[model samples]
Target: MERKRGWDTLLSADTHHNAVGLLAREMRRASSPLYYPIALCLLRLLTREKTSWELPAMAFLVEALDCPDMTEWSDSILEILSRRLWSQCTEMHRLVLRGLVLLSKAPGMADGVRSLTPSLVELLCYTGGELVGMVLSVLINQVQDRDIPISTPTALRLAELLPPLFGYDNIHVQLLSIYLFQKVMELAVDKSKQLLKTHVIYSLLPLFFHWHHENQDVAEASRKALLRAAGLLKRRDLVKLLKTEQPWRFSECLLENDKRRAVEYACQALPYLESPQEPVREAALRFIGIAGRYMRGQRVELQVAINVIEDMTPDSAAVKSLALQTQEILRAVQRPQSSPGSSSLKISSRRCRIGRLLSGAAAGGQRRTYSGNPV
Candidate 1:
């Protein structure tokens, strides 16, 4: 007890190396009850010291003392370390974080550290990529334990953290965040799964089709995770997800299936023709062309397509050409199937001429009234 009391005085007096040496010598005496006092002294020195040298000494002491026997001391140490996260010292934060990571890996230390989930979630918002990755690693390990379920609040906090990181600038941070997200989605219980679907799926859909991502591994992982999400979601839920998340998928799926429902949903792609993205506009026009074959005599749908085609510019010549062909096919299919004679063909030719005249007049901002009089 005298030697332990003297060691605390030495630790507080700025002689950190000598204090650490004494603590190490005392720690070697396995039966000594000096671990708690030594741990308390090191934690105090860790939190109070602003010097660079003492930080590593304190961290080294904590690491050296880490064992199953020291598990009971984890809560207090974690609390002090978590509080240190708010400090302005980056080195101190790094030391505490490294200490936490080491402690979390020790036998019987994970459960105690798991209680710090709220603190860990808050740390996820830390701007430092290293800090965020360490926090994610700790949480990932904790969640992998089936016996210890993550609470709803922690899960929700994690969901909030996921979106920004999915597009994070750092590749390692991006990959680790994604891996943590996948693990959470897979391990979440049924109730948590619903929360994820409601909050997360909308953000994930674009990644499934992010063909431009430089990293093939990230793109492939996103695609696989998206397919997994699709499997778990109901068809109606998926349709809802695609409507706002990736409307192109919804339209493409409708076009591929060609169900009766496709007719109603095919119109959804019309807005995409006016999208600023050239690819989106082209895809929209392509879907419309395919759907028009089944839309013969559907005057409303055909008229909508015509108006869209008329709005196109020379820049969209490919789209316009496809739309024009589709318009002709639709008009041909509108004629009565029994009326396949030359007269029907002449009518169709005259109708095309009248349609062109109307389109030209409309483009020139001219309006004409047909009062049962010859042109």
Candidate 2:
């Protein structure tokens, strides 16, 4: 029984290869925490000089991943396990993520993962650039696979992990995080919309607006994350966060150094400004004006502007004009406004009609009239 301090029977080469069956049998026991240490031992074996066992270790992990009780295992143990594996994780990243994806698909896993979510969130903050990107990518895929809702602490944990990642010295991690976060927002459940207001995501503004040291890839990632989060939540508080967080300084930075991303992030916020509070509307319009000016000729930026305008109130001659102009610009790229654009225009016009009727009524009277509005 003389064993290494960090090593256990599950790590023994002979036993570790057989761990899937061992862990599976124990999985059904009442004291589920027992498997936590066992899982950690397997993780350690995988990270150590035990190449002969890689496939079997992965198989073991895959099995544990399938076990219904896996998430109920201890948080400290999982953290230790992930930390040990972080540097040496290699191709295991996909496997671990795939495992988590499978676990998430199990009807009861979220409830279990919920208990250890704080630990999982902490892991997001601990790893280096590449490892963090791998972790987030895995989590995103699993979330998509399981159709996990965004309001859960687990989802927010994943969101909060992205901003700091913008500072990561690696361009690939930054780009990967940006790409995955966009997909995550697009795939998130509609009911989780209100959770988007949480300040965890608000912290990203500084990175989006002021981080001059970052390269285009980092800047692009920051831009995409802000846009995606804004589109999902539609909260003006995000605007205030950017402003109050550092207005004069950020303005100077954007003006002097990196206007492209600032413009992109601002353009993304415009669609959410439809009938917003005066301050929010003012801020959004200001950003759109700046973004629009810079975005004029570039085909991609122009396309984004067109999309923003299409999503806005059609009654505003300003919004309508911008959209119409965008159509003309897009025409040079290909052909005149296509079906998607025309359909959006029709839908936006109807929204504007509803808005005018409400605006014409006294504020309090209109409140009573549309109190039952589903939205």
Candidate 3:
């Protein structure tokens, strides 16, 4: 019961790690009910005021896992742990994640895990390698075994962050990010399903591109995510196409229903023209062509797509043909030149922003390709 007296060594000594960790470890196995006070003592030391003490506190906390009463402190443990997952201190943050990982397995921890969605999604933007793998494994835990409802705001942020990761070099990241996205679609609050509609709409073409991924798992994940997206958008026709494995018609169906965003969708599809995989390039080129049909007066967006397509040097003859075919499709439909008296060609600020973004992505792709890295 006097466990608090031994806690000072955690903050003051370089030698306490082994002793504290060992004591915490042995406490978990002791016959008497002594672990809780020790665990509670460790938890109180996890504050920012004692930066030196935080890691030891978390380390001892982890060593005490499976202690008979661990779950009783879950909410507090989760609260403190969730706040530290973003710690700038690398080892501290990792220990926090490891603690959360163990804490998450206990019953009734779903709400705590659900609150973690935004943090994990945000972390995906900044971390990679083993850190990314760790964050993703924890994120996968968040959505599995039960429905962990995410807020509309979190869904919106996640929807934005997840698409770019569809091509992450790490196969695990690529796979987990896509799978988690589908759960976001399924478990987001019902009313926000409509709010998530626009994001879902934007994801269709990219998901379709990855559907041809060489990695069977990634391809399957993309397909499943696209299916969930279609269901969320209430596009039964598109759903039937995906369910039936008819990707060729899926792009056309998607554009036919949402023709208005053709310009936006086409811009999003432009960068995939440089994809190392021929099938992805071919899929992107094909979709851009169909999307071109809907771009009659979208002269600015049309020419932007053409400029990027012109940079494509085909890996296969079919890609070359599709490139030209798409060129012709876009060329034939571009609105005629302004009348003689017309002022400068007016472009929307929105289109200008899209143009800049596509150009930046294409440039990034080239730089990374030259360096043999994933953008």
**Pairing residues by index, what is the TM-score of model 1?**
0.52
Residue-level lDDT of model 3, residues 1-375, one tens digit each, is 136545565455664654566567667677337777867777766633556666667777877665656677777778787777788977677777777676667667767776777777789789876677677777668768767687788878888888788887788888888887898899889878888887887788778888877677888889889999988888899889878776666776888888888888888888888887776887787778778767878888888888899987656765675577677666756757456776554434434543444344334323422232111
- What tens-digit string does per-residue lDDT give for candidate 2 at 1-375? 223222365676655534544454456364467765666577666555557556556655665655544555434324434443443444455445445445545555545444434554576776654556556654554455565555555555555666555445566776666665565566556554456455434544433442222254554455445655654555454444343443222333343344556555555455435632232233343344444334434666656655665666545444344345434433343323346646887656754543443232223222322232211
Write the candidate numbers in order of decreasing TM-score: 3, 1, 2
Could you tell me the C-alpha RMSD of candidate 3 in Å? 9.8
Clashing pairs in 1: none
Worst 10 residues of 3 by lDDT: 366-375
> Poorest 10 consecutive residues of model 1 by lDDT?
366-375
- lDDT by residue (tens digit), candidate 1, 1-375: 255674565556454554554556566566347765665666667556546666546544555546555565666677667767666766567666767777767656777777777877887777476877777677766766444566677766777787567666677766777766666667666678787776564543334333124466665566455545555555554445333344334434544554564456446556555644444355455556556556656777777676776677655555465556555655554554445555777776866664563344322211221112111
Candidate 1 wrongly placed segments (more than 4 Å): 1-54, 62-72, 145-147, 209-212, 235-251, 254-375
Cα TM-score per model: 0.52, 0.35, 0.71
Each prediction's whole-model lDDT (CA): 0.58, 0.48, 0.73
Candidate 2 wrongly placed segments (more than 4 Å) = 1-119, 145-147, 183-195, 198-207, 210-221, 232-375
